[model samples]
Target: MSDQSALQAVIFDWAGTILDHGSRAPMGAFVKAFAAFGVNISIADARGPMGMAKRDHIRMVGQAPAVAASWEQKYGRPFGEADIDALFAAFEPLNVASVRDHADFIPGALETIAQLKARGLRIGATTGYTRPIMEELMPLAAARGYTPEITVCAGDLAAGRPSPLMMWHAMAQMGIWPAHTVVKVDDTLPGIGEGVAAGTWTVGVTLSGNMVGLSAEELAALPEAERSRLRAPAEAAMYAAGADIVIDSVADLPGAIERISASLKAGKRPGYR
Candidate 1:
């Protein structure tokens, strides 16, 4: 819920926040892209830089120690821009194809957005995906009843997450104001960092995003203790990245927003600073 003295917009990160369940699309594409180059990366390698633009993500994975060693062994040299370019080229098409297959909305995502809108908060989104990938994804998501007022993609600005540029861009395009009046809901450290940088309230989503990395069915299959064991590291990482609040998924979003709105009314704001 919101008011004149409370929160304004709710900016979401696409994959884990609104859809894709476990943020599975890019991971498969990443693994396959690197494997195409004979690099043979694991899921961790594919996920370690989960919130970055795909090329930057590939670059980050290439710099991982195990990946570096593998690259040197295969290419007779270290990974560099040429390798990043090649890997990214391989990644994009596969990512687009993979996204086409995995755009299902996270449970409660549609309902959460509806609740926010009902409370007079606008819905916006940002993503680490490029335009081509988003171009393929938006229609599917829209058909499922998610049409955000604005969606800023990775390459929409000169910089993306952790830079605050995309957040600022989205706010500007949406004609909303005062960074602290907005809430950034995301599941990755870089995404949280962007909110922190932009002075917006940051909400980290644990289970539904890349950090927990399990599909809805898979996560539900885990015992509560095992689930906590898995969620510990991810939740800690979000707090470490300056999240103002953390919740299990968008299902808990209403409570989180209500808390933030109260904080705004109390003249408190994002506290990480």
Candidate 2:
């Protein structure tokens, strides 16, 4: 609530930030996708490129040296476009089928978004899922009363996260200009990079995202000291990757925005501070 330009909008990343509390679906899909190609990857590898478009993410994993080596051993050739397509094909149905199961709204996500909308800030969302996956997710999320005014999926843009096109698309569709007036909330490094590339205040959500990848129940089961121990590195990684601020979850977003608003009033912008 500084005298600076009023916060205009918040662009959220779908999976971990709002729906799919722990961002679980994509990781499993990516693992299965690679397994179909005879490339076995650890969950850490699967999560490495989290927040990029699904196809792009598959391609990235396929191109990794270990995966590529596995492919070379399995098929006597390098991983290529055909492999990427096959992996994506295998991944799509599994992802689509399980998306609904993961569609539960993260606790406080709807409430936080409602609060933002009440304050007159536009709600927009961008996601790594393709339009079809979003088609599945949207109605489920809407049924829970957490629909954004604008949603731009991966296939809808020429490029996806870390490229900033999806963010730009959301801004354009919402008719919001001056990127600094916007805030981007995401759960992964690539998503943070997208916001930085777009020159917006970027807030990273830790426990609910790729970093922790823990369900609310599971996270709650951990002792307080253990939870803090688990969160520190993920927070550090996000900050090092260019997040302007990092919070525990989307529930903490309003406070992050208030702090960012103060900075905006002080003439700070992403990459300028």
Q: For each predicted model, how many residue pairs clash, with residues at least 3 apart or on different chains?
A: 0, 0
Model 1 residue 27 distance off true place after TM-score fit, in angstroms = 0.5
Writing each residue's lDDT as its tens digit, candidate 2 over 182-237 gives: 99999988899999999888999999888899988898899989989989999999
**Model 2 RMSD, rounded to 1 decimal:** 2.0
**Whole-model alpha-carbon lDDT for candidate 2:** 0.87
Pick by TM-score: which candidate is best? 1
Candidate 1: regions farther than 4 A off: 1-4
lDDT of 1 by residue, 167-203 (tens): 9999999988888899999988889999999989999
Cα deviation of 217 in candidate 2 (Å)? 1.0
